[model samples]
Target: MKPIVAIVGRPNVGKSTLFNRLLGHRRAMVDDSPGVTRDRNYADISRFDKPFILIDTGGFEPVTEDRLLQQMREQSTMAMEEADVILFMMDARSGLTPADIEVAKMLRRVKKPVFYLVNKVDGDKLEHESAEFYTLGVDRFYTISAEHNRGVLDMVDDLMDTLPDVAEPSDREELTKIAVVGRPNVGKSSLVNRLLGYERVVANPTAGTTRDSVDTLFMCNKKPYLLIDTAGIRRKGKTVEKLEKYSVVDALRSIERADVVLVVLNAEDGVTEQDERIAGYVHEAGKACVFVINKWDALDKDNATFGLYVEKVRMEFKYLAYAPILFVSAKTGQRIGKIIASVDEVMEQYTRRVSTSEVNRIFTEATESHHAPLAHGRRVKFYFATQVGTRPPSFVIFTNQPESVHFSYERYLVNRFREAFGFNGTPLHLMFRGRDKKTLARQAHNPA
Candidate 1:
């Protein structure tokens, strides 16, 4: 799991600005759709040397002063509890306030490393003004302009150096970690039991390989898989009854550990708000996921029922357009075999790699089919594109006007790539960058 680094501060202190700045290119995709609050605040940040999850606690618009401060206090307290590292931001322009001191006091109590940040320090003058914050603080503060990228890199670099055990992607190809997560009693245990009873492996799992979650090694058609089920895992002194609500935390932990997630939904209940949030977390985490509608036997179906259900799911999870959905009954064991078959196929696409020439060719065709609209009176052009990484294949597309490229056009290019090469059950990241056409041409001719 990537370490979660959160930005917590009072309203209008540039928390969101710093969040967007840290995100860089991934910003657009993270804030893709309107009305998606969960995704808007949390982003999978990987551009930097040390990757982490960046959370913006300042998601709301400024309200009445008293209420906003109250909200900020609540937000800061919650952030301190959850985040691995906390970034306490104070506005250099506004100067230190009672709220900043209150938040600082809270931060002082936490065992985690709390970075004191004085934002909006645009110049040496403001940097000097930022020193007023030191009255309540013991350690030094980093003065930064989150909007202009001033002193932000230095702060992040120092924080990264201080943070220990950053979760880097493993090079070794090991057992595929599959997590089964859903609302409590949503047939999570039933499905896990069925799967284990059906395909539990002969040999015991090696020692010293256990995760915080309960993991069982199983085989499907001679292939190995390590099951990370949210249901089987129990927190100390927490009863199964309490787990209904508490399992959400466990589910998130399971997601962080798994490469692929099985977002199981109870057919009788249909799609709940919790289900959508859980699935949204999977998408946010960039894990290849499949939606399993469990207890399909309970739902009385007509010819139109399945289609209607599928359409509703598509509507709810508009962002997860790529994930494959399966209608299965863990009780009946109907269509059980299809689960692994689909997983195998999806993994193939999830870890798929397209050659640079082919990647550029598809983008070329995509633009030819629907030319990217001109932005700011200049014609937008794509010089070249190369698949940078795969685990949800990411591409860095060199373009003349990187900033001018519209989000819709980027989405169009993503659709085109998907059409040409099926990226089923996976998300695609297309990062636009500024590169000269001459440079691309030289590289193209040389064929590195």
Candidate 2:
């Protein structure tokens, strides 16, 4: 299970702002109003290569039968109950309050790791004043300006060091990881909620409700897979707020860690340049990708019209022609099951293993079908091949002279491997190794 970190603090203390900063997105609604956030938001947060679950709790307001504030308090308490680490946030600008002391007392009873944070410490004066938070008895403290992003990285770095060095699951061996990525309000979280068969992830009509990359683990065909529901990714120039900028960064980071990325496009809006950019990131990362045309039920499609849109999407993202596209309605649960099954199939194909003999046979057939280009008066001889790894299947090809192998020929080999093996919706890696003394020694031992 991923480690859980909870952010708890009073209203207007920048808990949501800190949440946005840590997650690199404005997932939580950040307003001047004290009780803007009503529910606990959870996201899969990563700093560097380390990944952990982060929960953003609503502002702690004294309960007196007001339905919404009461719910907020309950959510904050629930977050504390589920947290592996709790961040007790206070406002350096506002100074300590009775509510802050109350929240600290509440956190003290919980037997989990807790850190005291003073937010809005943008300058040296506020940083010094933040030292007063030591009275809360939480030994760990970080002074940060979430809005300006001051000292945020230092806090993250310290958190990374404090995190226990637990054994992380290998990307290949762990259940297949599929990320849902797209622009704001494109129903990415809605799709995740449908897949999990419940409202595990909060889905709202408001743009950027799902702030962090929230992950939910479930079994498909008894194979464990993680579904990473990330914040909306907007184009760089379109981002006006510091929070939105962070959200985009978080979305891209989610794609970087995923084995397969499901790029959700708004069916009503068709495809946009932002969609193309998002798809580009997946292809550039060398990850298997699947295009999800969400809210298809709302689209006025008549048979051939859907086909045209698909073709258009393919044309727009020609580099990702290898990626498969699926249509679904997260609100109505239309085609949701098929989406899960397709993800499983793509993951299986991604991690598919091939025998050395089969690889050699296919190599021979491919070479005969399209001979390797001649270079420098010597015929480029591709002798043998073997599977080196999976999770984006990589192979090493033994050649007479590795340096003689042109990049175009390598692409040809990779295309041939895809044609023969059907590693659909996955990237392929090819490496050239010169036939040297080590190769001869291995051959001599085998004597075949």
Leading candidate by TM-score: 2
Best by lDDT: 2
> Which portions of model 2 miss their true places by more than 4 Å?
1-5, 11-78, 84-88, 91-93, 96-173, 218-222, 374-378, 400-412, 433-448
TM-scores vs. true structure, each candidate? 0.56, 0.71
Q: Runs in model 1 with CA error above 4 Å? A: 1-173, 198-212, 231-247, 445-448
lDDT of 1 at 150: 90
- What lDDT is obtained when candidate 2 is compared to the true structure? 0.81
Which ten-residue region of model 1 has the weakest summed lDDT? 201-210
User: Which lDDT tens digits does candidate 1 get at residues 265-383?
Assistant: 88898887877877888888888888999989998889999999999899999989888899988778978778888788778888899987898888888888888898988899888
